[model samples]
Target: MKKNEVPQDGDNLVKGESNWLNYAVDQNGEYVQEISVGWEPENIALEQAWEVVNEKVEEARTKVLGGQLSPIAFYMEVNIMDIPLLANYMDKYQWQVRRHLQPDIFKQLSEETLDKYAYVFKISRTELMNVPTNKNTK
Candidate 1:
């Protein structure tokens, strides 16, 4: 298919925004520069992605309410980060991050450690200490 032509229905590239290479010719028939024309297809992939995120958030919320997971775990799920990724972002070891996932351990964290986590999560220490009951509140 030509670069300038949009894909028909059921094409593989129909999921998200796509770039089309466009070209023009001068009066003397000299080839001019090309530009990428961007366009988005009509699709529900974005909605589906959001649904998955929401589902994860709900799962985390359940764990937090059940006392099986710490508030930190809920925030991590809300931010769509796993233990290793969050540990890397906070520059802490994986074991330390895992420990923090325990409510007892999280409550015992030093103010400095709490500050570091708050910085990474972009929230105040108070908010981190008090996990919201509803994900929508965040």
Candidate 2:
């Protein structure tokens, strides 16, 4: 696309407060960089993606609160991590992490085990032991 043809449909993402560096062909048929407010298609796609993320967070919250899964599961969703990633961070096997996500197993964990999980999740041991009542915050 030409430099002048760079999309400026609207700046929904940043509300006109930020600009993105974009490259396009100048009138001389040379590549040039320009600032763009935003592109509508990209903005819409991001909005949809965030909606899906929020849905996952909400589902995790529900499962944790209902005792169907441990707070580890909810924290995993919040951190955008999977069992393998959490296991890698905790220096444990995937089966161990998966087992930890079971509320029964989680409740029986030692302080040392819980502390490791808290450290990886960047939360206090208390916070790791309990799920927040609200999804966004306590």
Candidate 3:
């Protein structure tokens, strides 16, 4: 796969407007909400989702703190099983991920100029949030 080519999986992996979905792990595994964002992007949905998740995590931290933002470490476990296509794209062509998302330009993601991509996963926040701090620590 080349850098410019899009993945093989068809579009429409996620439907409708750009929004955030929540799923609880311990419960019956139901979708909690679809928090809609005012802006939309055809292919940068994951970036948007990451920003939203980061925002919520910050809010949680703020509540935990005395209403002040603090730098806390966290992990995000995205099940790429569903979005295999996007995963492949990232693996094959995403230079940032290739270099472990290092360097200023990759961290900024300013080079992601393409459009019209899709995500096969559910794109939920709770799942992403629980990844780093889950009880499976070694």
Model 2: worst 10 consecutive residues (lDDT sum)? 9-18
Best by TM-score: 2
User: Alpha-carbon error at 74 in model 3, in Å?
Assistant: 9.4
Candidate 2 pairs with clashing backbones: none
Residue-pair clash count for candidate 3:
0
In candidate 2, how many clashes are counted?
A: 0
Name the candidate, 1 or 3, with the larger TM-score value.
1
Query: Tens digits of per-residue lDDT for model 3 on 1-138?
Result: 222222222234354543543332324444344343222343467567756665655444443234221111122123322223443654545433333222233223322321112122233333322223332231
Candidate 1 lDDT tens digits, 28-48: 665555544333343356456
Error of 3 at 135 (Å): 21
lDDT of 1: 0.76
Query: What would the TM-scores of all predictions be?
Result: 0.69, 0.85, 0.22
- For 1-138, candidate 2 gives per-residue lDDT tens digits of 999999886655567865789999998999999988888888888778877877887898899999999999988888878889999999999999999989999999999999999999899999998888885682
Two-way TM-score contest, 1 vs 2, winner: 2
TM-score: model 2 vs. ground truth: 0.85
Question: Which 10-residue window in model 1 sums to the lowest lDDT?
Answer: 1-10
Write the number of the candidate with greater lDDT, choosing between 1 and 3.
1
